[model samples]
Target: MSSNTILSLVTPTISSPGVGSGLDVNGIITKLMAIESIPMRNLQKQQSGLQNEISALGQLTSSLSTFQTAMQGLTTAQLQA
Candidate 1:
């Protein structure tokens, strides 16, 4: 993604509050909270990335273990021969 998109995602736009008593205070708070959650979203993204890396490492380890086992079997067969 472009830098602008990333910046927009991290930064929130604030609008002027409503002019009268009928103003939707709840809506305003919701919008403000949504903006506040940008950091949380970023952290979640980071967490997801870490989880993926961990999964990849686990797969690599399993593959290496399997290879070691196979190599040992081959060595045993050669020694018998």
Candidate 2:
């Protein structure tokens, strides 16, 4: 990229205070609560997904054990033959 493009990208714009300039402590607290809830919601989703993965892994392990038992039976039959 060019130098002018980099300068424009790095420059910060100045602006006047927003509409909530005189916002009270209660308003800030409400906003912070909303922000904090977002992470809690995301954590819940991640935990649910992890639970599903664990359940699937448990099923896979059971299936593998069953397959191994079948293989052992087959080997024994071959040895008898």
Candidate 3:
């Protein structure tokens, strides 16, 4: 018995987009990606703002605690007067 082998060569083709389509595909994609990320950016800004508010609240609470301590001592001294 005899076997015959055949060899075939295939060439790969690359397609360049926006070549003849006259479309700014790259620019559009860039803008679309930016648009898609808007909500995340907004959420990040909101998170930062909330963090700042929380920090301010903590500072205010500490100040109020200190003031309360001072007022208690003054009240006790007056009570003994």
Candidate 4:
């Protein structure tokens, strides 16, 4: 093969940023990141909501357990009377 042909294949030609590359790479990436964040934000919101629900359920269970213990004590006292 000729040196000129080898050089042509090896050398990269420089063009203006968005000229040869038709799409706006920076703008496309920015738009894609924005689109991608929507689902992430929604998932975070759902996770926070689920955490709150779990905390509330835990509190409710604790309160019910306390109430049962109190009732059992009352029953024991009544049986001894």
Candidate 5:
């Protein structure tokens, strides 16, 4: 292969980023996204906590309903005694 053609093949493309500005823009954006998503991560944790609380409340409600039914059955039996 010709020397000129081989050099052109190995050279960096003009369209590559940070060619002129010399700034690591992709790295900067990645760090910025991590910082920007902090609130979203916190909100996701809060949502999981709330779902756990709701599940506990549902369990409590179910237990209370079962107790009420048992109590009514006992009361009916006493009335027929």
Candidate 6:
């Protein structure tokens, strides 16, 4: 068999007679599209996680502000007594 024939058998991108060389351009494109979408899906998950963390931080900040105000009130009352 010619080297071209062997290469076609080994690689899917080449065309061969009788046996298909597995070179399906459309299938390859579809696989690549699937691979590209994976990262985008991961980023969406990450963004959701980040939003949750931001919400938690906001709650913590509000709690800290309330605590500080309470402390200031106590200090002022002590000073007046």
Clashes of each: 0, 0, 0, 0, 0, 1
Candidate 6 overall lDDT versus native:
0.87
Q: What is the lDDT of residue 48 in candidate 6?
A: 99
Worst 10 residues of 5 by lDDT: 12-21
Instruction: Show model 1 residue runs off by greater than 4 Å.
Output: 1-20, 76-81
Worst 10 residues of 2 by lDDT: 14-23
Please say which candidate is ahead in TM-score: 1 or 5.
Answer: 5
Against the hidden reference, what TM-scores do the models get? 0.62, 0.53, 0.69, 0.58, 0.63, 0.53
**Best TM-score among the predictions, by candidate number:** 3
User: Would you list the rank order by TM-score, best first?
Assistant: 3, 5, 1, 4, 2, 6
lDDT of candidate 6 over 5-72, digit per residue (tens): 99879986754543565577777779999999999999999999999999999999999999988887
Q: Please give the CA lDDT of all the candidate structures.
A: 0.91, 0.88, 0.86, 0.91, 0.92, 0.87
Runs of candidate 6 with Cα error greater than 4 angstroms are 1-32, 76-81
Off by over 4 Å in 5: 1-22, 76-81
- Give per-residue CA lDDT, model 3, range 19-78, as digits (tens): 888999889999999999999999999999999999999999999999989887786669
lDDT of prediction 4: 0.91
lDDT of 5 by residue, 20-77 (tens): 7788888899999999999999999999999999999999999999998888778666
Against the true structure, candidate 6 reaches a TM-score of: 0.53
Candidate 3, poorest ten consecutive residues by summed lDDT: 1-10
Q: Score candidate 2 by lDDT.
A: 0.88
